[model samples]
Target chain A: MIKITEKPIDVQKVIDTASSLNAGAVNVFIGTVRSKAHGKNVVWLEYESYESMTVAEIRKIIDEASHRWPLLGWAVSHRIGTLKPGEVSVVVAVSSPHRKESFEACQYIIDEVKTKAQIWKKKYLKTGRNGFQQAHK
Target chain B: MKLKIKTFGITRDILGGRLVEIEISQPTVSLLRSELTRRYPDLENLNSLFVAVNNKYADESEELSSTDEIALIPPVSGG
Candidate 1:
């Protein structure tokens, strides 16, 4: 399952989608809004994406990860629009027969999405100004 | 050829809207980039930008048609 939504991501649904009887391991990565950025308090974050392209791009990333690892199932979900600090923004779930593949593939998928997906986020600082800088890892 | 390019993120901010129209003598991604930078000088300040044609990352040499979907993709910052 790969999706771009404006609503808050349901992390359990993502994990459950990747769960299967044949898999022994399910690794999950949850990305949340940070309270502070560049030493300033963040009031919120507004995420934007080229919606259709973002979905297709993430699907390709998942397909590539499957080729690189032995995986049973996987799901990637990203939330757009405004999100307050501590709100969940993204979730990646991968299931495999072993722990090693699940762990490594999950990491690779998130990293690739950060660098390659057609998504961007702007930070709204407590100073009442929106930061034009791109969100950093 | 005249084309409408979709903008998002900081490009949208820099371009002052979601879409901008431009006319280029040659319809190629490279030429489009030159036209865009010439019109919106602030776009040059982005760390990097990729031009997407029909929802895929397009090569600089790729040709463009008026009907193709074009967008300015700045460096991604999503997880």
Candidate 2:
């Protein structure tokens, strides 16, 4: 499953979708909005995406990871719109026959999503200024 | 050809709007970048900028048609 939503991410749903009886291990990664950025206090974050492209890019990342690892199932979801600190922004779940592959694939998915997805985040600072910056830089 | 470009993130602030239309003699990603930077000098200050042609990250050599969906993608910050 792959989704981009404005609603709070249903973390359990992703895990459920990725869990399979055939898989011996499942790994999940959750990314959240933080209250500080580059030493500045952040009030909130606003996420936006080139909706269609973002989804396509995420699907591509998943496909690439699946080819690199032995996977049984996977699910990824990203949230958009204004979110407060500590709010979930993204979730990636991967199930594999072994724990090693699941962990590696899960990390690979998030890394690819951060760099390749057509999604952006705007930081609202407490100093009365707000700006957008590239993630994972 | 006239092309409508969608802007996001800092590009939106620099362009002062979400969308802008420009007339270009040639329809290509590189020409569009030249036209955009020519119009908005501040855009050059961005660390990086990418152009998407019809929802896919496009290369400079990619040719664009008038009806194609074009967007300016600044450095992404998605998690």
Report the C-alpha lDDT of model 1 over A1-137, residue by residue, as the tens digit. Answer: 99899988999999999998999999999999989998778877889889899888888899999999999999999999999999999999999999999999999999999988888898876654644444433
Residue-level lDDT for A111 in candidate 1: 94
Please give, for residues B1-79, the per-residue lDDT of candidate 2 as tens digits: 9999999888988888898888998778998999899999999988999998888789999998889999999999899
* lDDT string, candidate 2, A35-133, tens digits: 898777777888999999888888889889989998999999999999999999999999999999999999999999998898888887665455544
Per-model CA lDDT versus the true structure: 0.89, 0.90
Off by over 4 Å in 2: A128-137
Candidate 2 residue-pair clash tally: 0
Error of 1 at B27 (Å): 2.2
Worst 10 residues of 2 chain A by lDDT: A128-137
Residue A54's lDDT in candidate 1:
86
Clashing pairs in 1: none
Which candidate leads in DockQ?
Answer: 1
